[model samples]
Target: MSYLKFDKTVMINLEESLTREVLRTNRKGAYHCTTVVDCNTRKYHGLLVMPVPAIDDDNHVLLSSMDETVIQHGAEFNLGLHKYQGNNFSPKGHKYIREYSSETVPRTVYRVGGVIFSKEKVFSLYENRIMIKYTLEDAHSATTLRFRPFLAFRSVKSLTQANGNVNQSFEEVTNGIKTCMYPGYPELYMQFNKKVKFVYEPNWYFGIEYPKEQERGYPYQEDLYVPGYFEVPIKKGESIIFSAGDSAVTTTRLKSLYEQEVDARTPRTSFFNCLKNSAQQFYFRPKEDDAYLLAGYPWFKVRARDLFVALPGCTLSIDDPVRFEKIMSTAVPALRAFMSQNSLDPVIRELEHPDVPLWAIWAIQQYAKAVGVEKARELYADFVHEILEYISGQKHPDMKLMDNGLLFANGRDKAITWMNSTINGKPVVSRSGYIVEFNSLWYNALCFYTELVGGAPVEKYDKIIKALDKSFPETFINGYNYLFDSVSGSTVDWSVRPNMIFAVALTYSPLTRMQKRSVLDIVTKELLTPKGLRSLSPKSGGYKPYYVGPQYERDLAYHQGTAWPWLLGAYLEAYLRVFGKGGVPFAERMLISMEEEMSLHCIGTIPELFDGNPPFTGRGAISFAMNVAAILRVVDLLKMYNAE
Candidate 1:
């Protein structure tokens, strides 16, 4: 049996199948995302969702979905699912599903009467294309397959109505038809490996609902246009390949292209392998020379903080240091550009976030740990000095190095940290003033850079380092043996947040051994969950444990008490730091429970956050790069400890 196989019982149940989603990306900014039953619960779900740089930065759903029909003896059984108005599902093709597995490519097997059929899907690794291969495994007699294409041709964030503006005209290509819904959008080319019949009957399917959007209090209904259907004959043991892409391809090469893509996939045979495969999916290279790591699936773009935080674990933890260097080569220049000119790259955003440069240094620290300090210094020495000088010389707009040797930023008007959930243009949790993690990362970066350069650089920052050692504990560590979340002049926020975990987690932490133990104990007691650490402690006032309701309510709970899996990377690192080899068993148990997450929510990948309460349901973005990278880092840490 496949590691990620679901039987007929699970496949037929909408509750079990619809909540579990599968995602396939083409390394470029295109993807195919849908529920396990092939139903699109969200507007972002589509068969071919790709970025149109000319239209907008957002991904557009060119080919919304395709319905397949099995025709035998003049009777047709449509093997496709779509949710319409009034909580109804049309076609109801999920009932015919016998098994669904994704060990390599996503394959769905169906048994309609005496005929057995299967469909396998794979996204092209280097191009904006999605390929589906259909196999008629067994048939009592001859069978005919019919495919009807539904085109949305709208941005993922907006819904489209049945309008008079649609082009509605299509041109015939080799065994296919190419159509463009609107101007400034690339034409969609849908082709087959062999000859087929095309029927151009254009119509609009109205009131197609996306329940996920409805739940989130957004516009949930749209109209999809279907231009035509294709029909082809099939024998008992014959297979055909279908390709949908932005550009036209040679019809004869479709079969070979699909096979080559499938053959190159990494099998998700184990928990570690599953994470490794998911980590590689975040690689987004718009141009040949520029590469970036996307924050998460469905909606997230390439943000500066997420790229640096997720870089080491996503690449180095997967034992691919070459990728680590490759991504950094492009990213470091962007970082420099942002620092010097206050300019942001069009693709890589959020470079102005106060802690991004600090996170970049921390990422380089991870590289130094993996492949000696000498190599890291050889590559990142100038960049490291530039960042340090930028902050210390007061070149940053928001971040300021204080006389106390801690970095301070004002978040009263806007958010500067990663807990950047806001409502009505103001920060929800404005953790301003001297934040714990920022200082922790600052101290760590200073020490690492000083050591990387040795003698002179050590003396250069010695006074500031000494001041931080005394002032860090004096400002943050309270009488309760736990660090304060944030400290201002008159008021101090003592919320038990996961931010304090960085005080004990970083390589060159300023916290003493006893202080590290105390902080870890408080974190494990107050914020730690099976999924990860809660953003805020429940014991504090205004603690919202569950992340639900509409946009406003969800944003209120986004950082109040919602659990984030990315925090686990720091928690485990602190645990091992405080307990050494004796902590291995407990750390391993935490990781083992995380393995059960592979089969939950988004199969073989981790979500962005979860409910802080019991039965912690996964929420937010389906496949988060930071969550996957953090888990992979835990796996790497465990392997090193076990081998030692």
Candidate 2:
């Protein structure tokens, strides 16, 4: 049995197919993401979601979906499925699906009456284009396929309305038609490989609700414009290619273009390969030689902290040193851009997270190990010293250096850390002052700076290090052996959160051997799960078991108890550090448990987060770049320990 192929039993069931999603992305910030049955369940779901440089930097949903219908003789069978406003389904094409396989590219085989055909989808490697090949396997008579293009032409975060302002005209190109709905937006081209008839009928489909958006408490319903439909004749053993992109393609060269796209992708046959491929999808190179990683798919932008935390695993683990340097180069300019705005923050104020600059130092240290210290320092030393100086000089209300010589972030802005979910202006999971991970990252950053660049900075780092060594162990550790999550004025949050793992996992840990072992033991007993480590221990109060229901409810559980797969990287690193080579088996087993996930949701990619409870159902963003990087990092750790 193929790991990624769903049989008729699962495909025929609309509920089962709708819950699962498939995501195909080009490394250059473009994607085709939707449900397995071609029914969109989220506002972000689209056939051509790409960045329009002329309009804005954010991605937009141009073509929402393309519905295909098979016409034979005088009868027509709709092969496109859609979920309407009142839990009603139209066309219901999933019933005709015999099998859905993502073993290679996303391939679906459909059987209607006496006609048997298959559809394969492939996105372009570096462009905003998607090609769908429809092959008629065995048809009794002439079959004509009709393709209807649904247009959204709006930002992924917003809903589109059928307004009178939209242009309802098309410009004819070679075997294709190009049209633009709004000003400043890129023109969309719908091209066909064979001679086809374009029916110029425009109408509005109203009250299309996205259940995922509704759950997130956002406006989920919108009106989509159907520009027209393309009618193409087909016979048995013949295949036709349909292209949707901003630029028109040469119809005669469609086969070569499809072959090139398929050949460009790295085959995903195993867990490691699947993760490697997933890592590649996150690398977005907008300009020549400048690369940055988007944090997650279907809705996340390029976050500073996420870029540094996920860089080593996404690039280095796969042995792509060139990309590592490319990413580093881009970060320098990003920091420079922030500095230009006269802000001490690592990134812009809106995009700033206090811990991001600290994470950059940790990323530099990891990059140093891959490419020698001399080379790494030669490239990143200035960037590192500048960030450290900026962070040290600033004394913000939210993030400040206290008399205790440890960094403190006032839990006032809980969004400053990774547990950033908020409800009604209040943080769901508050970790305010003297955060564990922030301190650990700060300590490591200082140590790394002292080791790399010795000057006035070294003396300052030495004094802070001495003070942290005394204050950290004295104030944080409880009688239970594990450290407290955070310490405010008089209140000690003794929550068994997974943030403590970083203390032992970083390059320069302030925790001693005994302290590291205790932290690992407690984390293993409480937070560790098959999918990843839970944000909060189930034994703790206000532990959310499920990540469902409405927006506020989901936010309450997002960080309160959601299991984040990205934390597995830190857990695996700490396990190796504490137990040396002996911990290799445990790390291997942990990574192996997620192998079947390759065939599950977001096929071939790791998810953003999972539910805290048993059977840890993958939830949150479908395709997360950091989660894939975390898995790759764990694989690297295991290889190092097992080799010894």
lDDT scores in order: 0.92, 0.85
> Per-residue lDDT of 216-311 in model 1, one digit per residue for the tens?
899999899999899999999899999999999999999889989988988998999899989999999998888889999989999999999999
RMSD of each: 1.1, 2.7
1-644 per-residue lDDT for model 2 (tens digits): 45577889998887678778898898778999998889999999999999887877678999999888999988999988877867988888888999988766889999999999899999997889999999999999889999999999999889998789999999887777999999999899999888888999999999888988887778989999998888989989999999999888899999999999898877776788889888988888777767788888977878887888899989999999889888878786776556446454332123367787788788888888888778877988988888777767763446888777788887765577888888888788777888899999988888888778743457776888888889888878889999888898798898889999999898887889999999999999999988889999999999996888777788888977888888988898889888888888788888877786887778888888899888888888898877898889889777776676
After superposition, candidate 2 runs with Cα above 4 Å error? 1-3, 53-57, 161-165, 336-351, 394-398, 402-404, 450-460
> Once all C-alphas are superposed, what RMSD does model 2 give against the true structure?
2.7
Give the TM-score (vs. native) of candidate 1.
0.99
What's the CA error at residue 446 for candidate 2, in Å? 2.9
The deviation in Å at residue 21 for candidate 1 is: 0.2
